[model samples]
Target: MLIDHFPVLGLRVRTPRLELRYPAPDELAALADLAVEGIHDPDTMPFGNPWTELPPDQLARRVVQRHWKTLSELRPDSWALNLAVFLDGVPVGVQEVEADDFAIQRQVHSESWLGLRHQGQGIGTEMRAAMLHLAFAGLGADEAVSVGYVHNHASLAVSRKLGYAENGIGRGVSRGKLALEQRFRLSREAWQEHRSVEATIEGLEPCLSLLGAGEE
Candidate 1:
């Protein structure tokens, strides 16, 4: 089976209201359509790269193309699990957890987005909590980090709700202007204290080696 050969394809992190998993081709198509529909407001750029500013067609194409690149380029030392975000079995967005030298550093970084239509229902916090569970509980991570532009209130709110402490400040250019970023960090201890959502991980053991997390 494909899952046996590519165990990452079988990874899943599920919460009561959300599921995070590798996107099947059909699900990936749905995500692309969702991206074309929209994510953030036009006047503000949440990401440093300003990917959401691309034309509709280009944005859709980039969604699919980026997923392909992440899949093909995965390695034990550096990898990204760009799981599609599904709510009630419907594709809504993406929840990504990535790491560099994970086994040595035991840390992961996460980012996510929900369709504009899907925002404001707490799905963002729930989906992220699910990933946090996968990182700290299933994968034995030490710390998890996230960064949000100071103006991106929704992302910052989610981080605050999840018990992330301010790590530092970072400055960058976004949309050709200065962007102030609030870097946040959540240690495993903090996660355990702040975690309110229940989540479970399935099919992670087989992909441990690929994530540089296998028993040594």
Candidate 2:
């Protein structure tokens, strides 16, 4: 019944090893707890924002708060869907896809993070592949883009493996210092060409209207 109203909650994206969905309360807690343990190396700031730099408690609170905040602000023209990432039914991280004026632009930008323990073993790349499928194939998006810190090889590697080519470079301030960023873009054709992970999406039809993607 709840899903009947918020069909986005019913949506699911599955890859070879990960399942991503609008997180239920308990799952969101698990995801938050995962963030408390850690995300990335403290020595280097990989994110453009210093979210992970907060104390563990503050960071965990931010994790849960951010998810709930997004839920309250959904709109057809501008919206973000932050899905909790799970491996073997255990929450491990988060993946977010967002767009402003999506109906007109037909483009989506994405970002994600994994618990420190889950950073390797190809999970990050596979989970991202799932979202790329959801965008280009499931939602008819024309292009997808992401910004990664130049030294964030892990994030950039995931983009590269998923067929994202460098769009350009920009400089930003992160952790009170200058940071170089690489903008990456992937077209539908490119996604199809380099997509290595197989992904399956479920229950997306009912949310198409909400996403303004029904016309596609």
Candidate 3:
């Protein structure tokens, strides 16, 4: 029998209009559909990772595999908290907050994507703020970081709104092409100073220990 993992199964974080959580069995299907439908225009590259270049179907499969692999492996060194971004009960996208050796890093990195239809709604900003709350307030992280292509103004704008300051720039290859990326960081102090969103977390207690926290 599969021992139900409460930490993974019961995680949840919420903002005014959205709830970010680990997808339950029923919700996971919906999340997969959202990925299959495509998060952005096929012609546009929004991520530093070239995995987004796959054909629509392949991209969808990868999304499903990611959810499964993360759960099955349950590794301590690398783990990703994949939250299905819901707006008014509909699956609109995926928000991934991740870390490597989080106990040591004391930092988390974020990545997210909304369907093309959902772009320009300010949902991105609110969603990102929700994750920030989880990292800083919920998990006691020292800082949070995110990156975007230099030309992706919308993403960079969202990061700026969430109090992320430009850290530096780096060149990397994506799909065999050199790309310039702007890295941004938000220290706990900056997050406290600039936090604006009102958030509440539910169903997180069971997972608190997994967050590398010493005590509740």
Candidate 4:
């Protein structure tokens, strides 16, 4: 019944070990609490923006606010889809894919973070690969780009494993200090080279037009 009114909720992306889709209200709260629990080492700043520096309550509030903002501001040409990632039916992290003028550029950008407990496992790679499947295979994207802090080796490794080439370095301010960000580029050809994870996407056809993928 709800899918009839909001078709985006109908979309689903599934990997061998995970399921990713728009988070319901309860799931959004779960994702927020997971963020508060931990995402990375407190001594190091892995993200360029430093959103995690806030106190737990503020950080949790930011996470919740961001999801709602993205949903409210969505446009066909420019939008962000923040999906709650569930591994074996347990909430583990958030996977975000977004674009600016997607119809014209056919480009997408991605960012994600798994809870501290879920890290050091292959879950991060699988979650990213699953989103890449939605971007490249399901939506027909030409390129997908990601940026990670230079010292964020784990993120870099995941991008490399997914066949992304090193684009260059991007400097930015993080926690009032200059941060080295590594840019990664994944062309369709490069993406085709890596397919270790098997993924399936469902309920995409009805929403294709809204995503500028043309009518079925």
Tell me the TM-score of each prediction against the true structure.
0.97, 0.97, 0.91, 0.95
lDDT of each: 0.91, 0.89, 0.80, 0.88
Give a tens-digit lDDT track for model 2, residues 122-160: 988988999999999898999999999999999999999
Which lDDT value does model 4 have at 77?
83
Residue 193 shift from truth in candidate 3, angstroms: 1.3
TM value for model 4: 0.95
In model 3, the runs with Cα more than 4 Å from the true position are 1-4
Tens-place lDDT per residue, model 3, 118-200, is: 77888999889999998888878899999898877889999998889999998976557887999999999999999999998
Candidates 3 and 4 compared by lDDT, better number = 4
Q: List the pairs of residues colliding in candidate 3.
A: none
Residue range with the least summed lDDT across 10 consecutive positions in model 3: 1-10
Model 3 lDDT at residue 214: 38
Which model scores highest in lDDT? 1
Query: Over the full model, what C-alpha lDDT does candidate 2 score relative to the true structure?
Result: 0.89
RMSD of 4: 1.5
Q: Write one digit per residue (lDDT tens) for candidate 4, span 47-99.
A: 87789888999999999999888877777788888888998888899999998
Over 4 Å off, model 1: none
**Per-prediction RMSD in angstroms?**
1.0, 1.0, 2.1, 1.5
User: Of the pair 1 and 3, which is ahead by lDDT?
Assistant: 1
